[model samples]
Structures are given as structure tokens and as C-alpha cells.
Target: MPSQPTLAFNRDHIHPGDRLCVAISGGADSVALLLAIHAANTAPRESLGVGLSAAHVHHGIRPDTESDADLAFVEDLCIQFDIPLHIHRADIPARASQARETLEEAARTVRYDFFRSLIASGHADTILTAHTLDDQAETVLLKLLRGAWTEGLAAIHPIIHINTPNQRPGKILRPLLQTRRTEIEAYLHALNQPWRDDSTNADTTYTRNRVRHELLPQLRTFNPSIDQTLANLAELAREEESRWQAELSRVLPQLLLPGKPVRGGGRSVSTAPGHSSLSIEIERLRPLDPALRRRILRAAARQLGSRLSFDETSRLLALCGFLTLPTVAARTGASLHLANGLRADRSPREIRLYREKQSANPE
Candidate 1:
């Protein structure tokens, strides 16, 4: 039999009077995470105190198996451990269509939103997810396939601040981030713990499932320790991103134009009826390297609640340089209308970003 999991948590950030809300899906990884923490709490560990609870998201996508099976397992598991279980239900298909996102993307959004609601309502302070090293490897592979940037290659952070609309921010911690999937299952098996398997995990039609079952196996054939390789890559990336983000933060203020709405100026006007605009001095950006320049522009776009694709970022940069506005060719400036109502206008000195007037309601 496999040895029992040595339950350990990164206790530096966890505090007394802080309630931990573990996101349990009745899967082996989550089951291990909760059970380990509960065990620690039972023993009155200083780090993981007795304040342990769980939140489960029931995405009723599989009418046959998930609607009843998954939830029943989680409910039973929580009861057995005597942990408080908070259940939230979401119609992932409907959410996907309404949000114009893929079903996977919609499910993720709904899950995090549920966690945020729990925090906003004072139900839990720290939200924990059971994303293992295998999951991290799978994520890095997915991002690599999609041509991700350095930040994307970082895979997942061990902890991050979670925020929702009008809600006070809270932290989400991944205690089992370094744990492997096989190790989780072994831990559960050693405890004779039972967990429900999601029927969809076997569905190769899903990109993640395919990556796990197909691509990962092929890659392992080349490198016997592919999982470790990917995990190491992610760890290196996380450290690099930590340093890079700090530099990015320092450089952003210097590049932003004074009295021209650049860093934190995208919120108020974007929601209001009238037009909203922000500007960055061309001179400040011109001195930076191309990679840094693109990063700055991408950061600005993100603040405005719009993520730019590679093509979009490239075209936007072109607008800042030589591209002249088609309609306003007679003028010295250039204008490029982007997603939502965001309009980018560039003069010789500065580039301004704002929402244009739209007659039609977004609803």
C-alpha cells in the first residue's frame, strides 16, 4: 500500500481567527487537501487552526452523473469529517452562452465567483483550491500550446488576492500546490477515504482531458520525468514573474502621462454614459525597449478591463508609431477603435484610450 500523505501546509501566511474555506469537489486532490487540514485542525496546529470549512460548486452540466452523484459525495464527505459545507449551484451552459465564453471558461468563472461571494458575505476568509503539481504541469503545457507570455507560463501562484465587484478582497491559498496527483490519490487510499470521479474527466473531447491522456503520455515517452520537468519550469517561471512584475510596477508610473489618465483612470468613465479617455506620453514609451513597450501597453489595456491579443497589441503599437487614421488622414493623429467602446487616439506627444459614444445598449 502507498504510504499516507505527510500533511503539511505553508503556515507563514495563515493566521489565528482566519477561517479556511477549502474548495472541495469530492475529487481525490480536494479530498486530500480538506482531510489533511481537518486532521491538523483536530490536533490544534498553530498554523492551520480549527477554523476549517468547505465550499463546493455544483456545475450541473452532466444531468445524469454530476447533478446528483458529485454533490452527494461531497455532502457525505463533509458530514463524515464534520466540516461545514457550503454548496453553490450554477448552470455552466447558460453562463457560457450568455458570457460568450467556452464551457470550460464559464465553469471556472462561476466557481471563482462563488468563492468571492462566500468571502463577501463573511462566510470564509481564505479560499483553498487543490491544484496539484500535475495540474500545474498540464496548465503550463496548455499555455505553451497557446503561445502564452512569461506571466502565463508562470502557471499558478501559490497565493493570490481574490476580489469581486463591490466586495472586499480576500486571499486564496493553494496549500497543495507542490503535491502531485498520484500522491494525493495515495493519501486518500491510505486513509481508506472514498471520492467520486467526475464522468467528464474521461471525455477526451475536452482540451484538458486530451492533454492529460494524450499529449502528456507522448511527451513522457521522450522524457521519462516530463511531469517533474514541467513542474520545475513552472516554478522557475513563477520566480521570474515575481521579479518582472516588481520592475513593471516601478516602470509604469514613469511611463504614464501626468494629468492624462493612465494607470488607475479607466473605471469611472467606462461605466458612465459619456465618453471616457486616458493618455500616455509618446516620449516616455519611445525610450523603452520594444518588449517593455508592448508590456506597458498591455498593462494599460488590462487596467481598462480589456485584454489585447497578440495581433491587437501589435496593431495598437503600430498606431502609436506610423499608422495614420484612415478617416482622419488629413490630421496628424491616428485613431483605432478597439473592443467594447475603447477608442485609441494617438497624437505626436501622447496616446489616449477611452470609450466612444455608443447608441445601442449592451444589454
Candidate 2:
């Protein structure tokens, strides 16, 4: 059995006055999270003095009966715990057709949309997701298989602001991130709590299921502490990335044209004298750290409303060099095509980042 203190330590990270909406999927990990939160609130110390509620999003992808069964199970658990339950249902098929995307992507997008709606309607403040250590291990390995960069290797974060637009940004906290799947099962068994298992989880058709069933076991033969090691690596990467982001945020403004928009659709500098397009002095930027230069380029791309993929980053760097030499301009277009109405113009003294006017509605 896992130490009760470990559970308590996880719960302690959650503070009082935090309105947490627990994402309960009628799974053992979620059930354990719900019960553990209840236990912490009722403990003698009484650490959490805030509101607690259970929220479930029905994807409507599974059979009607099976989906209903999962919803009913979650409802019953919420009732047993004396917590208010908010159930939101979404039609995945309809949304997929409208969005022109795959079923998996559509379902994920719809579920998050529903979660944002809950926050918008004052249903909850923080969304507590039940992502265990096993899930983290699976994610890290999956990303590693795909040749992920530092950010991708970082995997799922313990806490991050939901990026859904037009909604009040609420926090998504993964309190169970450090806990293992087997430990959650043990906790549920000890409490005599029943959970509904999704049959699709056993289906090896899914990449995650294949990794969990086949790859992880083979790895455990060599190192039983595989999950812990991966989790540690994620934590370290997160810390490093956080520091890198902070430094980039501090240095980005000087590199940009005074009034140009920063990446991610916002002003470059809040307190700048004038609001105008951002002009990048490429010569001045060359002396700074290469990592900082890359971040600046990435930010510029985002300002144009386009996310830079790993390949895009390399292309942007190549473009920077191409701009320095006048001979290359006749062969390749002098400007780089960044998405979302943004482009970079390389001049002798500076690289100017500008946002273009578009008739179509911005996403």
C-alpha cells in the first residue's frame, strides 16, 4: 500500500479558498482523487476551506448504454461523497464534421470546451484532472518515440492555464500526477469504491494502450523505477523550461519593433511609448544567446497567430542567415511566411516583424 502521507502531501499542495472542480470519469484514479479530497477536507487539520464539486464530460462517442452507465456511476459517487455534480454532454460526431477533424481530436476539443463552459458559468474555478504517474510515463515515452524536443519531453504539466479563448482563464491542476495507477487502485479497493473500466482501454488499437500494455512492462523488467525516473525527468525539464521562458519574456521586447504585436496576439510591450509594429534589429539580436534568439523567433511566429513546429524553428533560423546575405533574396523570397498575418522582413540593420490585415475572421 502507498503511504497515506504521500496522498496528504499531494492534497496539501491544494490550498484553501480554491474552488476545485474534480474531473471524475468513473475510473479508479479519479475515484481515488475524489475520495482523497473528501478525506483531506474532513481531516482534523482542515486544510482546504474552499468549495469542491465533481464535473464529468460525456464524449457521446461510446454506446448510449455504456455512456449512461459511466455518467450514473459518477453521479452515484458524487452523491456518496456529498459533493455537487455537474454533468455536461457533447456530441462528438457532429462536432467532428463541423471541425473537419478526426474523432479523437474532436472529442478532446469538445471536452475542453465543455470544461471551459463550466468555468464561465461559475461552476468551478480550478479543474482538477486525474493524471497519474503511469500516464506521465506513457506520455514521456510516446514523445520520446516521436523525437520530441525539450518542451514535448516535459509532457503533461501539474498546473497550467487552459488555453481556450473567449473564456475566463482557469487553472487546470493535476494533484494526482505524482501518484501511480496501481496505488490509486489499491486506495479504491481499500475504500470498497467501485469504478467502471472503459473497454477501449484494453483494446491495443490505441497507441497509449499499446505502450501501457506492452512497452512499459518490458521496460520494468530492466528498471522497476521507470515511472519515477520519467516523472523526475519531466519535473526537471519543466523547471528548466520555466526559467528559459522567463528570460525570453524579459529580452523579447527590446528585439521587437517598438509597436509591433508580440506573438500570441498581444502587444509586445505594455508600457512602450508608442503602439506600432515590432521591428527586430537582427544585428543587435545576433550577440545574445542563441537559445534566446530561437525563443524570440518562436514568439514572433505566435504573434502572427501561427505556432512554430520543430521544423519551422529550423526554417526560421535558416531564413535569418539568408536575410544577412543579399544574394539569396533573388532566389528565395526575402520574407518568411509565418501564419496568422505575420511576416519577417530582413534588412541590413534590423529584422522587422509586422502583422498583416486580413479580411477573414481570426481564429
Worst ten-residue run, lDDT, model 1?
322-331
Query: Global lDDT of each model?
Result: 0.80, 0.76
lDDT of 1 by residue, 101-164 (tens): 9899999999998889888888888899988888989999999999887788889788989776
* Candidate 1 segments whose C-alpha is farther than 4 A from its true place: 1-5, 44-47, 64-66, 164-169, 258-274, 320-343, 361-363
Q: Could you tell me the TM-score of candidate 1?
A: 0.83
Q: After superposition, how far is residue 275 of candidate 2 from its true place, in Å?
A: 15
Tell me the tens digit of each residue's lDDT in model 2 across 224-315. 99989998888888888888888878877766666434458644554533222566656676677777777788776666466676665666
- Candidate 2 clash pair list: 257-278, 257-279, 259-276, 260-276, 260-277, 260-278, 263-303, 264-302, 264-303
Best by lDDT: 1
